[model samples]
Target: MEIKLTDQLDQIYQDARTIRHHVFVEEQGIAETDEFDGTDSDAIHFVGYVNGEPVVTARTTVTKKGVHIQRVATEKAARHQAYAKQLLEYLLDQPMFEDAPMFYLGAQKTAIGFYQTLGFEKYGEPFEEVGIPHVNMRRTHSAADHHDR
Candidate 1:
C-alpha cells in the first residue's frame, strides 16, 4: 500500500476521518465530544491507500519548536497491515516537515514501542489521554534516519 498526504478536500480527508472516528470513538470508546475537537482545519492530514481505497490516517502540524504529529488511526480491517506506519513515514518525508528539528507526539502506551522502533524516544512519565495511558515521545531529526528511508 502507498500512503499519500493531502489537503482537506481530496476525499481522502473524509476517509481519514472515518478511520479516526472508528478507531478513536467507536472502537476505543472515547467520547464523541472529546474525539472530534476542532483542530483538523489547521493541520495537514495523510491517508494510506490500498488499491485506491483509503484505510489509515495520520496528521501533523508545524509548531515553533518543530513538527507535532498526531491523530494516527487505522480502520479495523487495516490494523496490523503497517498502514499507519506508511502514513507516518510519508508525513515525515514532506518538504515542510522533513527537516524539522523534531517530530513528536503523545503516543498511546500500546503504541509507544512501535514509535520507538521508528526513532521516537520517550521522555515524560505516562499520563492519561482520551482516557488511555499515553507518553510523550519525540524523534530528533537525524540525517542517518532520513537516509534509511
Candidate 2:
C-alpha cells in the first residue's frame, strides 16, 4: 500500500472522503453533518491506497495544544490489515510532524487497543460522540522512542 498526504481538498482528499463516507456515515450510522464537522478544509489529510484504490483515511490538525488526529477510518473490507498504522507511521515521519510534542485522538471504543499499540494512552474518561462511545487518547512524542518503530 502507498500512503498519500495532502493539505488541500484535492483528489487525494476526495478519495479519503469516500472511505469515510462508507465507514463512518453509512456503516456506523453517524450523521453526515457530524461526520464532516466542517474541519477538513483546515486539516492535513492522509489516504492509503491498495492496488490504486483508497482504503484508509485519517487527518491531522496542528493546534497550539498539539497535533490532533481525527477522521481515522478504514474500509470495512480492509480492516485488520494495519493500513491505518502504516499511514500514521508515515504521517509522523513527515518533516512537519516529526518533532511535534504531542499527538492525540478521540478513538472509538472498539479501537482503543489499536491506538494503544501506536503509543497512544487513554487520558480522560470515555465520552459519547455522534452517538458512539469514544475515549480521548494521547501520545507524547519523543524522537528517540518513536524512531525505533
| Cα TM-score of candidate 1 | 0.91
* True-vs-predicted CA distance for residue 23, candidate 1, Å: 0.6
Lowest lDDT block of 10, candidate 1: 140-149
Runs in model 2 lying further than 4 Å from the true structure: 143-149
Q: List model 2 lDDT by residue over 65-145, tens digit each.
A: 789999999999999999998998887667897667888899999999988888888998999988889999988877327
Error of 2 at 144 (Å): 7.2
TM-score of each: 0.91, 0.94
Ten-residue stretch with the least lDDT total in model 2: 140-149
Candidate 2 clashing pairs, residues 3+ apart or interchain: none
Candidate 1 clash pair list: none
For each of the candidates, give the backbone clash count: 0, 0
RMSD of each: 1.9, 1.6
Instruction: Compute the lDDT for candidate 2.
Output: 0.89
Candidate 2, 66: how far from true, in Å? Answer: 1.0
